[model samples]
Target: MVKGALLAMGVLGAGMLPAFGPCLAAGLPDTPLDRARVLLVVQELEITLLTHPSATLALEAWCATHHMADRPVVVARKMTLPPADPVPGRVRADLGASATQPIRHRQVQLVCGTHVLSVADNWYVPDRLTAQMNAALDGTDAAFGHVVAPLHFSRDRLEFARLWSPWPGGGQGAGGMITPPAAIVRQRAVLRDTHGRPFSEVVETYTDQTLAFMPAVDADYAH
Candidate 1:
């Protein structure tokens, strides 16, 4: 599990922020205080994820930051495995012919205690994985990261998408407490073995549980 403070990277490139900058700019409350809060929240999210080696590691660190370090398990639920579908054009291009290597597709939810932090879909090249790694993946709910821990895999982030709240052009009124944007942030990346051969492609979605754990901001922050 991750420990101590995070070391964030510069992943959010130019324009992604201003283009989707604080919803306050859209005029909900529209105060300096509200805008600062939104920016702070977005920065926190960026830092938290940017520094982590992988979403799995990020979630583990988040659990530690949130004081759930006592429980070691981070993957709460490993839902049924679905037959791998035709790889996306981008993923196909990323992995090349290796993309056709027998795929093992799985969906899993990472949690800290009872709070589900993120849900992810991992499509991995089974032949690229060791026999032992494949066995663990097939027999248990262990996270792909954990299952392949022995391989000392490293991840390369390829893309990031911030899904805004209330579905493009939705309501923005204050309802209850300081409402943080009910948005989801997604990261798409490939995991490689120690030799740097890409073995898996994963897409992880940070869920509402993330906002619930952090300082709340405007509901329309990214609407």
Candidate 2:
């Protein structure tokens, strides 16, 4: 399960904390380190949904009912050739669904350098995680406006510093002498809504460790 994978990555936490000061000041929820992790999970769910036959059928039925079968959507994948070949490639899927025989999946082949990649048997995905992902996608879309505020606040509070540097600048001065200075960098959080609006905002400060959140959002109130 995706939740299990997240748990393995240490995303859940002990309890809910109070919302104080600025939204960014509140700190991240005991969740993954950043939005990237969430996005990867979302992508995986989307792939699963797209590949599952049952899920495809459902989406096809919906598309047909809505009369939106002619729309063209694009999907992509990266590919690498065997060591002996040294070629690179990609695969792209163009899909359209409708009320009648909705869900037409196509495969395209790409060749680059000395490599080739192929995509085939376009289908629907119907996993439990896909349903959860759909819900999360919906929630993200509904809360699009408010999400950025907290992310920005968090970045201001968390910072990191580098420990090592070369002394006297250029080429290790005088008998390999080295100097180190305390360098500070801040942690930033980013998120994206369903419409694909990139939210590059900082929300809170964090230690070099894992955090988690319990019931991160109230599903009843999300919509």
Candidate 3:
């Protein structure tokens, strides 16, 4: 129902807001603070997403940097709700699907250790993939990008929406305590193999769990 509610909200873009009393880095002094660590987290996430080709891998880096978890990212095939919107016709056409060709839908949460960093909705052409690739996708919890890596796929971006940006909001908070959203950013793209054939279309919704960690802060960083 929660996913349904999000979908019914017209277009699912980015985030929701909550207080930051519990997210502060341990042993950091903030007496003279003019900014919040959450601000830094947002900026870091933005730049990482912009520069990285694979959000799944980029998030693995983030998890390692933040020490949020000790393991590589994994996909949890836990999203049971049908996508709020039907696969757009344009997506089918992009994958070169004929009227009779079959397209498959998959949705899963990308989890790192304990936190769910993001949820992804994917529509892919089964015929474009190898039998092993399709089987791995259907049976394993492996991230889509990882499973399809053998194809040497590259992302073809369609759009990016930064639903919550600290700079845009001035990073101002009540008493300098910011409340960040559950979702911070979203992206839509297609995956093209080495031959430049589109095989999958994905829509990813990044959650605040991406910001769930104590960033490495130098002693003088806040000064």
Give the candidate number with the greatest lDDT: 3
lDDT of each: 0.60, 0.22, 0.68
Q: What does the lDDT come to for candidate 2?
A: 0.22
Error of 3 at 106 (Å): 0.7
Candidate 3 lDDT over 138-207, as tens digits, reads 8888888888888888888888877765543443345444445566788888889999999998878777
Alpha carbon deviation, residue 84, candidate 2 (Å): 3.8
Candidates 2 and 3 compared by TM-score, better number? 3
Cα shift from native, residue 64, model 3 (Å) = 1.2
Q: Which lDDT tens digits does candidate 1 get at residues 12-77?
A: 221111111232224434345554654565457667888876777777876666554477358747
For residue 207, model 2's alpha carbon misses the true position, in angstroms, by: 24
Candidate 2 lDDT tens digits, 1-223: 0111100112211111222112220232222232333233224333433342222232233333323335311212222222442101110111121223222111121111111111111122112113454353234322211212322211111122221212123222233322111111112222223443332221111111111110132222234
Q: Higher-TM-score candidate among 1 and 3? A: 3
What's the count of clashing pairs in each model shown?
1, 29, 2
RMSD of each: 9.8, 22.3, 4.1
User: If the candidates were sorted by their TM-score against the true structure, best first, what order would they fall in?
Assistant: 3, 1, 2
Which order, best to worst by lDDT? 3, 1, 2
